[model samples]
Target: LIYIYDLPADYNARLLQYKHHALACTWRGFDAGNHTYLKDSVYAVETFFHEALAVSSHRTFDPEEADFFFAPTYLTCYMWPVHGWADGPWYHAPIPNPRPMHAANFIDEVGRWVNATMPYWSRRGGRDHIFLWPHDEGACYMPSWIYNNAIFLTHWGRLDADHVSGSGWPPDNYSQPVVYPRFQPLDWRRMYKGHLCYTPGKDALIPAFKASNSYHRSPLVGVPPVKKDVLLYFRGDIGMYREWWYSRGIRQSLYRLAMEDKWREKYN
Candidate 1:
C-alpha cells in the first residue's frame, strides 16, 4: 500500500501558485479548467498522479500499513520556467513570476522537513520513501544523501546521463535547475556527473504526464467503426532534424531505418 506524507502546502501547492506555470501552458495552446489548470504543462504529471492516488482505493491512511511512502513534492513545476530563452513573454511582464529557490536547495529543504517532522524517513533512512521527480533529466541533480537510499518516480532514465541542457533558459530572473557554464567542456561535466539518476531495476521511470481529459473520447468526435490493422508502435524522443545524437543515437537509427518500406509486410 502507498501512503502519501502530509507535507505542508509550501512544498507542493505553493509551487503551483506561481502563475508562470499556467502561463507556460495557456500560451502554448493548452487551455485549462477544473483541477486541470496545470494540465498541459509538460512537467505537470505529478499533479495528476498525486490527485488520482489521493482519492483512489490504493492510498492507505496508516503509515504502518504502507509499503511505500510517496513524497508528493512537485519538483518538476518548481524547476520549469516560463521559457528557456530570453524572448519569453513573461520575461518583460509588468508582474513577473516570483523567483523560486534553487532546485538543489529545495530538495534539501524537503528532505530535511520529512526527516524532522515525521518518523517514517528516520525509520528506514528513506529507503521506503518514493520521491516524485518529473524533471527533464529526472532526479539527476538530487543530493546523494537523499536519493541514494530512496525510490524516485521520474520521467527520464539514462544510464549515461549528462545533464548538458539548462533546466530553465540560462538565468534571467528565475533561478533553478542549475546550468553548466556556457564554456564548460564535456569532460568537466562528466567529472561532476551526479549519482544514480536512474538505476533501472531499483528506480521507477514514469511516462510524461498527460491529463485525463485527453483520454476521454467524446461523442462529437466519434471514431468510425472498423477493424484496425496498424501494428508496430513506438513513442518518445525520435531524433528528428538534428536533436544532437539524442536517444543515444538509437532514435536516430530508427528514424532512418523505419523509412524503408521493404520491412513493412515482413515486420507487420
Candidate 2:
C-alpha cells in the first residue's frame, strides 16, 4: 500500500497560487478549439493522479504504516504560467526566456521543509519517495540532489546515451511504464500508423481530454462508403535538413528518393 504524505496546505495551494499565469493569454491566431486549448500532457496526468489518490482504497494517511510515500504537487502546472507564452506556431516559436527557476526553487524548499518537518524524507534519503515530473523541462530542470535520490515518473523516457550523459541521471533512477499526456482524437481508427504518438512497449498512453476537438463523430444517417483512390499520402513539413545528429536527415532522404522519376510514377 502507498502512504501518500499529507503535504502542508501550501504545497497543493501553489496551483491556485498561480491560477492567473496558468490562464494567461496565448497566441492570438492559435485555435486548437476549446477541447485542445489548455490540454497539456503534464497537467492532465498530474490531475488524474491527484484525483485517483483522493478516492483510492489503497491510499494510507498514516506515514508510519505506509510502504512508499507519494509527494503530490503540481510542479509543472505552476511552471506553466511563466513558460506557457506563445507568439506564433509552437514549432517555430522560441521557448520563453529565463527557464523556470521557480520549479527548482520550489523543489529545493520543499525538500528542505520535508527534511526538517518529517522523519520520512531522511529515513533513507528519499529512496522510498515518488515524484511525478511529466513535463520534459520540469524533469530536466530538477535539482541534482532531489532528482538523484527519488523515483521519478516522467515522459522523457527516450532513455538514450545522450540523455543519460547530459542529465547525469543514473540509468536505473527512472522506472518503466512511461506516462504521457492524453492524445488528441480518442479514436484509434482516426490515427495513421506512422503518425501514432506513442512507442508500443515503453509507454502507457492516457486518454484524450474531454474538450479535445481531435475526435469527430459522423452523423448516424445511412450513407454509402466513399471510394478510396489514393494509394499513398504524406503531409506536413519535411523539416530543416541540417548536419546535426537529430536533424531530419532521414526525412530529407525520403523526400529526395520520392522525387526520383521511377518512385514518383510508382506512387503518384
Candidate 3:
C-alpha cells in the first residue's frame, strides 16, 4: 500500500527536514550494507508542474506505490493535448486551435513545488522521466511511460512565442524528446552573463522572456550581482522573423501576419 502525505502549513521547511532524515537513513544503510548496489539501483522520482519545465531542466516527482509521500498543496496536476504547435504563427496570432483542449496553469506550479521540495530526487533514478499529466486526489493518471511518450509525440510542435517572459523555452518546445543536461562548470557564471534580459544559450535563450524591468535582483538563487535589464524586446516590425525576435511583443506581428494572406501562406 502507498502512503502519501499532503504538505502542512510550513511545507518548505518541513520538506527540508524530510530530505535530511531520508539522506541520513540512506547513508546509514550504505554503511551497514557495505555495498553500493542499493544506492546505485535506487532512484527517487517526483512530478513537477509543467510550467516550471519551461524555465529549468529538472523533473522532480515520482508516483510509486510504496514509500513515496508528498505534500499536494503546493502542487497540482497539469493536462493538455500533445498535438499542434503553439509556436510562431500559433502563439503570435489568436487562432482557434481545437487540439489544445483544456488550457490550465497548475502544471508549472506543481513542477516547481516538487523540484524545490525534493531537490535530489530527480537525479536518483538511472534515467528519470518526470511524467506530466492531469490527476485527481493527488494521484497521477498516466498509465505507462509509453503512454506518456505517445501523448508527447502527438502534441509536440513549435511554440509561437520564442520565450516566456520569466522562463526560458519549454522542454516540449522543439517537438521532440531529448534530454540535454547542463552541468555546473566554473564558466557557468560567464555563460549566463547576458541571461538577465535574454537567455544566453543557443536554443532556450530569448531576450524577450526576461523579467520585468522593475526586478532588481537576479532570478537565479546563489548568483553574483549583475546589472538588471528588461526582458521584453518591444521594438520590432510586424513580420514573422521580427515577431520571433520580440518574444511577447510577437502578438502584434502575429496579428499583422495573420491578416495578410501572403504572409500567412509563408507560415503554412
Candidate 4:
C-alpha cells in the first residue's frame, strides 16, 4: 500500500550514523540498546515506524502499484543536541540552542532537491505522498508547498507552536526561520507554511518509539482497562532548563504547599 522513495542518504539513512556518536543517539534512542523488544521511548518512533513500513506487507516496490508514497527523512536526529555525561549538554543555559537553523537549512535543501530531481512529486502535486516528521513541533518544521500537501505522521500536533520567545530552545524543540532562494510566499505571517503543527483532518499522529522487547517488563500492557489507582502520571522530567527563571516556577511553590501538614489530601 505504500511506496518508499529512494532518497539520498543525507536526508534519511545518513542521519542514522549519529547512533554511534552519543548514548542518546542510539537506535533505541536514549541509548536503550538494540536487543530490547518492548521499547517505550517515544523519540525512537521515526526509526521503528520507518523500519516497519520498509518490511511490511503493505509496502509496494513499484510506485505505480502503490496507494501511498513515503519519502523518508529524519528531522530530529539532525537537530538533536550533542551532549556528554560530564559537563552536560553542549549548550550552556545562557546560550540558546542553535541546531534548529541547521535542521531548517537541511529541510530547505531537501525541498529544492525534490522539486528539481524527482518526477513523482509533481504527480497530482503529491496528494498521495507521506512523510515521517518526528520533531518536537512536528509538521510545522516541514514546508507546506512541498511535503505539506501530503500526509504527515508526526508526534507533536500543535498548529500554533512558534517556540515563542526562544522558550523551547533545547536545540531540538525550538522554531527557526529559513530564507528560501527564488521561492516566494504569499503569506509571511507564519515562519513556515500552513502556520500550524497539524491540520485537523489532513495529518495524523504517530506514537514515539518503543522497542519490541520493552513490553516484557510491564504486565499491565494490555487492552483491558485496569482500575485507576493514582493521579499525576507524568513520565518526563519536570524542572528548570535554566536557573535564572524556569517557566514552570509555579510548580515548586505548588509542591511545597502540597507537602504542608495542612494540605496533604487536597489541592494538587
Evaluated against the true structure, the overall lDDT of model 1 is 0.61
lDDT for each residue of candidate 4 in 36-95, tens digit (9 for 90 to 100): 434454566666677888899999998888888887776665555322212322221222
- Over 138-247, each residue of candidate 2 has an lDDT whose tens digit, in order, gives 34445556666676666544433223212222221222112123422232211111221222342343432222332233133444554556544332344444332322
Residue pairs in clash, model 1: 84-169
**Residue runs of model 3 more than 4 Å from their true location after superposition:** 1-66, 69-105, 123-268
> Once model 2 is optimally superposed onto the true structure by TM-score, how far is the C-alpha of residue 55 displaced, in angstroms?
1.6
Which candidate wins on TM-score? 4
Ranking of models by lDDT: 1, 4, 2, 3
Residue runs of model 2 more than 4 Å from their true location after superposition: 21-42, 82-97, 158-268
Model 4 lDDT-worst window of ten = 85-94
For each candidate, the alpha-carbon lDDT, in order, equals 0.61, 0.49, 0.27, 0.57
TM-score of each: 0.66, 0.51, 0.19, 0.67
Candidate 2 at residue 127, lDDT? 77
Write one digit per residue (lDDT tens) for candidate 1, span 1-268: 8999888876677656663634442213334453323335566666777877899898999998898888887665555643232232221122223222245446667888899988998899899998887765566666677878899888768665444432332332222322334432222222224676787776898877555465456344685544556444444546566454344566667767777654556565
- lDDT (Cα, 0-100) at 261 in candidate 2: 46
Root-mean-square deviation per candidate? 7.8, 13.8, 21.3, 6.8
For candidate 3, what is the lDDT?
0.27
- Candidate 3 weakest ten by summed lDDT: 39-48
